[model samples]
Structures are given as C-alpha cells and as structure tokens.
Target: MQRFQGSPRSVLSTLLLVLVMGLLLYPGLKNIAVYLFSAITGNYISGTHSVVFLSCPNEQVGKVIARTIVEKKLAACVSILPKVFSIYNWDSEITETTEVLMVLKTRTSKIHRLTEFISGSRVE
Candidate 1:
C-alpha cells in the first residue's frame, strides 16, 4: 500500500488523483479542445468532413506532400502511414513497391479547394 502509487483496485484514490490532476493540468491542455468538445457534445465536429487518401513512393515524399497540404490548410490533418506494400502496373511493367499512405482529413466543402490545390501542386 505504501509503495503502490498506481494501485488499480483503489477506485476512490484514482478518482481523487484524476480530479487533482485535471485541475492542475487544465491550463496545459488547451490544445485538447477538439477532444474535449467531442466528448462533451457527443459529436465528431461542427463541420462536415471527409478523408482523402494518397500514396507516395517513400516516407520523405509522403511527409512533404502531407506537410504541404496541412500547411496550406487544405486538410485539417494528414496522417502518413509508412511501409505499405503496393502492387501496380506502371508504363509497360508490373511493379511492386513499399510506399507511404497519407490519409488526409478535411471538410467536405473544401473538397473542391483541396482538389484544385492538389492539381495546381505537383503531387497529383
């Protein structure tokens, strides 16, 4: 009891610790507004949004494209999942390669804007 600061069976102890921690950590959690909002409202978000997926040959290119979209606000967030195996036909050869997959989340209203941005940029 004296050494176990993280005892799983102490429900009251956990609650009290969590309450104190919340109060102490409130100011540091400003960036968590979206999560808190979703929890309180039981809604994903205010806007209608969708995710668009794109794959790049490597992590570096994937990161660059993802970063560019996010920086331009074309997407709310871009997740780069690496080491994905892809098989496809390019030119006259069948090719298999390891790639990075980017899942971009953005508002539905911004789809056209996002598309335009992607077209204007060299990523498409």
Candidate 2:
C-alpha cells in the first residue's frame, strides 16, 4: 500500500495551483457582460445597420466590390445580381444596356469606408 503525505507546503501549493487555474479560466468582463445580456434578452448581437446598392459595369467588377466589402468587414453580406437591364439617358442619348448590381448590408458607421472601397475598386 502507498502512503500519502499531507503537509502545509503541499496544501499551499495545491491552493496556488487552483488560484492560477481560476485566473486562467476566467472569462473577460466585457465578454461576460455581453453573454449575460444576450442570455437575459434572448437576442444575439446584430452588428451595424445599413444597406448600400451599387452598380458596376461588369460581373467581374461586381465580384471584386463584393470581395472587398467582405474582406474589410465593411459589410456583413453582399448580394450580387448580374445582367440587370437598365435604360438611362446620357449625353442626350437614351441608352439601354446590361449591368451588374451589388446590394451590400453593413453597419451605418461603415458606409463611408464601403464607399471608398467600392470607388477605389476595379470599376469603370
């Protein structure tokens, strides 16, 4: 049979280990607050509230815009609807053509950033 040793030093070491583990396992205060709020309200965070509609000359450009939006987190989602028929007057001439449409949903705070990204993207 093996004999166990119970000493003050051993007890102190076990308590220190438990304290360290508790500190390590403790969740962040902000995260705990968010979790508690969501738990009580039964609603998860739905960040940002805005939607932007843009048109690009081609499907390729539309995809580029969409990719940039998602990569930058400027928008949560982008819906690309391509080959849209449109008629508009330009230079005193009525023009009918097909274009790609990009509908982006993002935070209102990120609208300017989204605009900059779209404007700077590969579009003509």
Candidate 3:
C-alpha cells in the first residue's frame, strides 16, 4: 500500500511539472513564432493588396511603366529584372527573345489604370 501511494504521488508530481513548464514557455514560444512569421510574410493583413506582374518589351519600356506607376502613386514598389529570355508564339510564329520583366507591386484597385497605361506604352 505504501509503495503504491508513493508511485502515484511521483506520477502526479511529474505531470504537474510538465504543466508548469508548458505554462512558463508558451508565451515566449508564441512571441518567437510571431516574430519569425512576420519577418517572412512581410506583415500581411486581411483586405490588403496584391502585386501585379507586368512585362515590357525592353528595359526602356519597363522603366516607363515603373515610373508612371510610382509617379501616380499607384504602387508601393516596382522591381525590374532586365534581360529575360521569353519563348512564345506570336503572329503564328515561335519566337525566342530577351525582354525586361517588371514586377509591379501596385494595389489591386489600380490594376485597370495600370493595365491601360502599360498597353498604351507598348514599344514593340
């Protein structure tokens, strides 16, 4: 009877210790996770915006698109990658060519205007 009672008490102590440790570490662990997620995800919130990928025929054309978006305050940022080779069919012919890729980080609301502006500025 004495041995049985001691074993139960030891098990209870171990469970209680685990519970206390969990309680103590939870807040710290949660904060660490939040920090890591924020660092990786760029502080996204519900109802925020998405970026648009706009391509231009050349660096000159891409720069024009980027400048217009920024000057109009339609975008927060525009990252341009030049000299990308694009392989596609145009006018019933397969074409392999180099072009500039502009990642236009604009709000969804300005997509229509941005598209119109980009379409009008095509230099091909």
Clashing residue pairs found in predicted model 2: none
TM-score of each: 0.57, 0.58, 0.58
Per-residue CA lDDT of model 3 for 1-124, tens digit only, reads 3555468889999899999999999988976676567559888543345778776788987887788779988788999998998999999999999998888776565788777876676554
Give the poorly placed runs of model 2, Cα more than 4 Å off: 1-48
Q: Please give, for residues 1-76, the per-residue lDDT of candidate 1 as tens digits.
A: 4775655769677888999999998865853775577668877775456889888888888887888889999998
- Report lDDT (Cα) of residue 69, candidate 1: 89
Clashes of 2: 0
Residues 1-70 of candidate 2 have per-residue lDDT tens digits of 9876789899899999999987886766555676667669876555426778888788988887788779
Model 2, poorest ten-residue lDDT window?
42-51
By TM-score, how accurate is candidate 1? Answer: 0.57
